[model samples]
Target: MIRLSMMMGRTAAWVACLVLGLGAAVQAGTVDVYSNNVGGDAVVGASPTVAIGSSGWYYSDVRVGGTAGIDSTFARSGNGSVLFQGDASAGSYKADVSYSTGESLGKLSDLSSFSYDWYRSAASTNNGIQAPSLRLLLGVDGVYKGALVFEPYYSLTTPGDVATDTWVHSNIFDPNMYLWSNKDLPFQEQFNHDIAFWKSEIGNYDILGVSSGIGSGWYGTSIAAVDNIHFGFGEGPGTTYNFEVGAVPEPASVVSFLIAGGFGLAGAAYRRRRAR
Candidate 1:
């Protein structure tokens, strides 16, 4: 019939363009940004693709000299960046129960947004700056417990302040989620604790942490810079692709859901041959 259905719709459009050109040369969720200036000093797992062995990051504070290296004089795009000395410590029991900017990023998957690129450097005295609230921390099944409690920017005025040309972007998932509370709004004005016990145990947490929680700590030696750090986003907005964050659709996101259901069933069989 009709030339055998136009040779079976051109052999299923050449097998969906050869499986979307081998799924764009086998690309799959891979993101890690320590600014790559090469973790020179700041010990404690001195990065190696960031996380594979040496515990990517950890520093609960009290001024252990608040460190974390690699910062070739500030970068917002690349080449180098991620120097967060912010010294200002206090650990007697809560000036920073300790958290030199906690990091572990292992098994990271689910993310629609987590951007980064915050630089503040009027040079020193900005100390171990953090207090503006910033905790994402998770570990679901592995159990580091969960947390969202946000706020990294509201800027009474100068967003990301200081200056190095102000590299502030920090999104961290829309309007800053939030789920740590005495009822919320920052559990009795700032962190009394009990955040609904990990937002009712949300799972699939492939380990991650990004604290600043339990405020009023560090803010003296100043100098922050972090860089282009990104996590997947987009299976929508102008679409590029995104799915990572397992517990389900693995296998290259099931070949991106069978290449988006074979182009949505070839656009519904070419609109049923223009409605006959």
Candidate 2:
């Protein structure tokens, strides 16, 4: 009976060690991009600029024929308004907000997954016509690297079109179907394009740029407004780090697990000897 009790104690100790080791191994990281707080406010400038609104939201502006190269007008009902407006020209423009190396919530070194919530509004005339949709780009260092273009199936018609607001989540690691079309083109072609873009554009950069106004032909005498831009990393589709747990296992955990396993085996052997 004494031998059995000793064996049981040994077994329990081994199991406890294993559990503790595994628990230690569990580590995680997170990256959150929001309009109101953090350093995510907006890149400051005239026309093609960003700022925080009285409502505590970030606004971006795109202007026409401005030094900022943005041909859009940005406005807001509150203290902050980043405008993207122009005088009925048809071209493409880009704007960006960058998070420095360690500013992100989780200090995500690698962009794993990304998601955002945005609201869109148009100057009441282009209801039936298709206006250019906003495209999201991820940059590294200071270069225009990779892009995640989202084309809304819906059209912008009126100002303050609250219905157009929605949350979009995507994995950076997965294939972006919205950017590539699969018809007669082979699947590999799309993959290659993405690879090239990511490698050249986002491979080692830390900045994230939000670009709008692509394609040609603009609806006459109208404007578009976007607000509440949010980017979340580590929890979404392609986010690298695991926000729920941590991105990778700590070194200590691996060592602990091995030690625990050794203890368990040793305890088992001791029990067998005692039984004999």
Candidate 3:
């Protein structure tokens, strides 16, 4: 009887460890957030086209000629990517897609990771390696605050530092590695101000949304695509917006899959214990 009780206690401890491990694993991995290709076709619109997901990502072209949409031709990984294109002929053309949903909004210090894959076409009439840029919009409610912008043109490497005609993966999570503009002044590009700086300066401001695209007098006839927008904030699991060309699994489907996997893992662990 004593030996059986000891074995039961050990098994309970092992099961507890397994459960904790599973929880950690779930929190660590990236879950699918949103997609561009919906209902087997590419969609584009001016000033707010919804990407298919519960996450509520939307594409917008603030200017008349600028446009943002799903492009099947220039994908970074999957069969599709979000494309931003505009000509300087239109006044300050700016096109972008943004996520203003709950998963994105939070205090500045709560951001743990932020990154995206961007592409610049060689055919871009822009003089240098012009590409789509990334932005973190800061504000509260519906009010407008300044944004933190990231552009590859600031790099001292090449015509733009980033290679054209191919996808460039950027890791902007580290404030030390990437330069960001406060966008307080027109075309005001500066660096070294990290998230901590923003927190100190504008303690009341919070992250309103995230955006990626090109234009606003960037150059003439620019073309770019963005994909795999991965980010984590507000104590939630990380999410990757895989802009793809096919049907993506629903959130419910993902949850069911995780639950099934957990059961399988637990069963395997139980069998191992029995063998022991």
Q: Where is model 1 more than 4 Å wrong at Cα? A: 1-75, 78-122, 126-220, 226-251, 254-258, 265-267
TM-score, prediction 3: 0.68
Per-candidate Cα RMSD to the true structure, in Å, reads 17.3, 15.0, 7.7
Give the Cα lDDT of each candidate: 0.42, 0.37, 0.67
Q: Each prediction's TM-score against the native?
A: 0.26, 0.35, 0.68
Residue-pair clashes per candidate:
17, 32, 0
lDDT-best of 2 and 3: 3
Error of 3 at 179 (Å): 4.4
| lDDT value, candidate 2, whole model | 0.37
Where does model 3 exceed 4 Å of error?
A: 1-28, 33-53, 88-91, 102-104, 140-142, 155-161, 175-189, 234-237, 248-276
lDDT against true structure, model 1: 0.42
Better of 1 and 2 by TM-score: 2
- How well does model 3 score by local distance difference test? 0.67
Clashing pairs in 3: none
The TM-score between candidate 2 and the true structure equals 0.35
Angstrom error of the Cα, residue 51, model 3: value is 4.7
